[model samples]
Target: MTDSMLKIENLHAEVEGKEILKGIDLEIRPGEVHAIMGPNGSGKSTLSYVLSGREGYEITRGSVSFKGKDLLALEPEERAGEGLFLAFQYPVEIPGVPNTTFLREAVNAVREYRGEERYDALKFMKFVRAKLKELGMADEFLKRAVNVGFSGGEKKRNEVLQMACLDPSLAVLDETDSGLDIDALKAVAEGVNALRGPERSFLLITHYQRLLGYIVPDRVHVLSRGRIVETGGPELAEKLEAEGYAAYVGEPEAA
Candidate 1:
């Protein structure tokens, strides 16, 4: 069995026959938080989508082992069943679905997949309410449609709430800090920090080092084009912030 929570070996992927990820390699151990920072179109989101088994992003070479299983072989829902979570850069709004109802169904689906007993209505409300309290979200959020009419911060906070409730083994935040004000960023970061523990791992994907200032990753990687070119400690994020991705992505791409 593999000791790493997420292991990718020479992964290659393409979308609509155009290659995006090229010979990428990464291994995330349990309890570690890793950050991927790169310029736009660096395949950061592609990597996250591939891991989540999103459609159209095809993996043509290599393998991904998550918790000792071949992650690529699993369907998207199956990947979720195996305890993977992804927070998107642009959260989609469901116009008619109430947030509480959506969250309840999601929680129950995961519970069923994990062979655990589903939470009853009263139980679910209690559990979700507590999580909302912890994230400092208002109770009225439950009655509103998912992401509909929510501010950028509220959408991100809702995602944090989902992370708290689902409690996945690996959570991938894909440019979650984008479009957030400083206050919103810190609030979202706090929610993510609260979930950090020995069994949980996080893969934070962003374009800037601003988010790193709050969450403080164990490893920071610089991805250029479609591959990770550099890896270092938290200081790397600071360096990238100071100098920018010029060395890794070149002057034109960095600008």
Candidate 2:
């Protein structure tokens, strides 16, 4: 088995005839958490969408491998089956679909893909309740429509809850800290920290260093003009927090 969880080589993508990602290269190993910090319109979200196989954006060039497989060839659902998860920056609401029901279906789908037996309702409830308790959430959350009528923090927390239930190997959190207050951010960070282990990895995309202060990524990459121009340890995040991305802007793309 390959030690690399995700590998991107010369990845170039465009949306609506405009190129966003240009010659990007990155590799993430198991048990590592890497953060991508970039200015607005720097293609951070685009990278996440492409990895998740979202529609519309075209992969003009390059290749992505996940677990030694051609990730770009797999359908979005197939990507999820491969233990890849993308936590949306803006989670959508689905009325009439109770969160519990949604989660149960999702978990069963992933389980079925892995050739594991599906969980019965009773077993699933017990399992999910434990996760909720771990995240300091209540039973009431399960009964509500997915993201419907949920506060900002509640929506983000609900995303974390899904992450826990899915138990993905590689989680791409795209701007999860956007619009969150300090307390909410802490709660989300704690939930993420709880899930970290030797078997899983994370790609946290953010604009500020405040989130890094809580999660403390193993490495930080600076995305500029849709390319990763610099990479360093957690200290790099602090430097960006202090000096900003101005220094890296307009620099030549990596060869």
lDDT of 1 by residue, 1-255 (tens): 666999999999999999999888999999999999999988999999999998999889999999999999999888888999999888999999999999999999999999999999999999999998988888999999999999999999989998899989999999999999999999999999999999999999999999999999999999988988999999999999999877877735333
**Highest-scoring model, lDDT:** 2
User: Which pairs, if any, clash in model 2?
Assistant: none
In every candidate, how many clashes are there? 0, 0
Supply the global lDDT for candidate 1.
Answer: 0.93
- Model 1 residue pairs with clashes: none
Stretches of candidate 1 exceeding 4 Å from the true structure: 251-255
Off by over 4 Å in 2: 250-255
lDDT of each: 0.93, 0.95
Judged by whole-model lDDT over C-alpha atoms, candidate 2 comes out at 0.95
User: lDDT at 120 for candidate 1?
Assistant: 97
Candidate that scores best on TM-score: 2
